[model samples]
Target: MSIENVKNVAVIGAGSMGHQIAMLSALGGFETVLQDINEKALEKAIDMLEQRMNDWVNKGKLSEEQRRLAFQKLRTTTEIKEAAQDADLVIEAVVEKLDVKREVFKLLDQYAPSHTILASNSSSIVNSKIATVTNRPEKILNMHFFFPPLVMDCVEVVKSEETSDESVQIAMDFCKKIGRTGVLLEKEIYGFIANRLLFALSNEAVYLYENGYADFKDIDLIAKKALGHPMGPFELMDLSGIDVGYYANMELYKETQDPKDRPAKCVEEKVKAGELGRKTGKGWYDYRKEVISR
Candidate 1:
């Protein structure tokens, strides 16, 4: 269907990206459902959403009435069938793994109405790969939002070879309704645009630190002071989660069999130690103690 016809939006996976996406949809006046299998995760997501909106209200970025109305338009669910049954658009923000995303899309295809558009928030793995498991490939495309969906204004709207022009237009219109700039890519590519550039910069930073040529903090200092970056590569990784970069790198390595695409040794070690990032309180930096470096 078209943007005007999109009355209900379902966001799968209640983790960082999914919940915030549902908030955006709700703020845009759609009946939004944020769904996850874990009830605790769903509860936590709602709590976090409330806190974030309250913070915005205190900062004068959002109004009390707007926050109340947005909450009124949003709901949480544990059942996939319940979330997708009446959805006009389904945005999957599950884990970055291909198999998991494919399964989510397959189930969405089965439960969502035939007119529902399917989208993925994958950072690297293209929606073309996920669409293989669904019959409505023409309605499936990438609606990749950056980290912290509320703060990020740009979205990468990528269309696979099979994605219909109508789907792309609808996705762009939906992004506008939610206060985001949608940059449409006519063809799919690994990492789309921004992440490809980021991967190259992050890869070199990891290499220098791993090789002992420079301390991670020193590298970050140089990136910020000399390169004019607001956040150093390592700090960005920690904020976004080291596990996310590790998994994205692994996916790239698996596809191209490129040794350079493999995750750095330190990333693997941090992930194994459960030092995922701000969420886990540790990564390259320790968030719990407010330490810049481990």
Candidate 2:
């Protein structure tokens, strides 16, 4: 399971994280495939990737030849079996549902090669549980990449009780090959590493906002400036999409079955009203015609 032996990588989701993963794999010189059930989403991922790669070249972060190579290595498709067949590594980044993941892993076990490293980008679901439905539990682990994997440098290599030393080493090596700093976690925790800490602060922020502790902007401002973080919890939540934070809050609460972990009503209410943050052009703050922060 050497990193050098991994020639192809298949990312089984076309959303933000999956698209980012595919781009990184291509940039790292692996044949990368992005597959999704939604054809439109797959197309969007490819187009956005092309634009981002061009941007990298313009910024002198990547050579034109390297950019062309990355584009050549990237592929998009809708067929799971086709994508899994020759992939040396298959990462599942689908919706964060245990049963849906179980179904996908079961199929992956049947279609993907025996030596393929099956990983989930799930931030919270237990890897051991997802692995239970697959044939090679040791080959299945959580390779949790941060949002926008192309930029952020940390990869969480989550190991379950069933994870083999070889499997863990392989994952860490792959992360390094892609120019990412890797952290090894002994057991599967609720939110892996980044998201767990993020959501902890996020939940508190929601509590503050709903209780009228401060104005929305103030809550966001202090978290960014005073706390010395890149973005405040609300701003981060907005950038990540409010619905994402809402679902994460709900999932965390269910995982712990604790009221303390429960999300505030204000968050759910916002999600219900379709104020889904950056993607939707309205979250903690509103957006204009441009999709980027000002």
Candidate 3:
């Protein structure tokens, strides 16, 4: 089906990325549904979306009528079938695990209509691996959006060998409809474009920190002041969730069996300690006090 055929959109996660993505879809004038199994997560996502929209309205970035219309277009559900049954497109933004993504696709394939295109917002695992479980491999591709989708303007529309050219074009068109710049990748890769670049920088930063060459804070300061990076690798890790980086690295290691591809000991330890960054109120740096003060 063409981009014109896409009228209903389902976002199958309510976390940081999924909620913002659903908001963008709603703002783009599609019938959008945000689904998650956890009731609290769904509630939190709705609350966050409302607060963000209000902030945008206050800042004159969005009109009150636009906010109201977007809200009218968006809904929430806990059932996958309810979300996907009538959807013309499904974007899966679940955890960064291959098995979890495969399972999600299996359900989306079963519940979504035949014309519905399924996309994964994965940063590491390729869509081809997840498409193996679905019947519509040609409709499955990576629609990888950066973290904090509302602010990040770029999206990677990655196509696997099985992905049709029509599907790629449709994804690109949808990205434009939602106010994002879509970069089309004719071939699939492990981390797509941006993340692969990020992974290399992050890996080196972690190496320096782990080997006692410098502290993470110092590294971050140098990156920002010297290299002109807005946020250092360690700071980026905290914002993006250290667990995400850990899991992505582990996935790469699983495929290549390269010792260097494995997650650094410091990262693994942080994950083990349940310090998964800002969402958890702690990570490379503690945010608990900041949260409390706020």
Maximum-lDDT candidate: 3
Sort all candidates by TM-score, best to worst.
3, 1, 2
**Model 3 per-residue lDDT tens digits across residues 1-294:** 788899999999999899999999999999999999999999999998898899999999999999999999999999999999999999999999998999999999999999899999998788999999999999999999998899999999999999999889999999999999999988888998898999999999999999999999999999999999999999999989999989998899999999989999999999999999888999999998885310
Measured against the true structure, the TM-scores of the candidates, in listed sequence, are 0.97, 0.95, 0.98
lDDT of 3 at 208: 97
Q: How far off is residue 11 in model 2, in Å? A: 0.2
User: What lDDT tens digits, residue by residue, belong to model 1 across residues 1-294?
Assistant: 689999999999999889999999999999999999999999999998898999999989999999999999999999999999999999999998988999999999999999899999999889889999999999999999998899899999999999999999999999999999999999899999999989999999999999999999999999999999999999999888888889999999999998988898888999999999888888888779774321
Q: Worst ten-residue run, lDDT, model 1?
A: 285-294
Determine the backbone clash count of candidate 1: 0
Q: Per-residue lDDT for 197-251 in model 2, tens only? A: 8877887887788888998789878987898888888888787777766676677
Runs with alpha carbons beyond 4 Å of true place in candidate 2 = 291-294
Sort by lDDT, top down from the best: 3, 1, 2
Off by over 4 Å in 3: 291-294
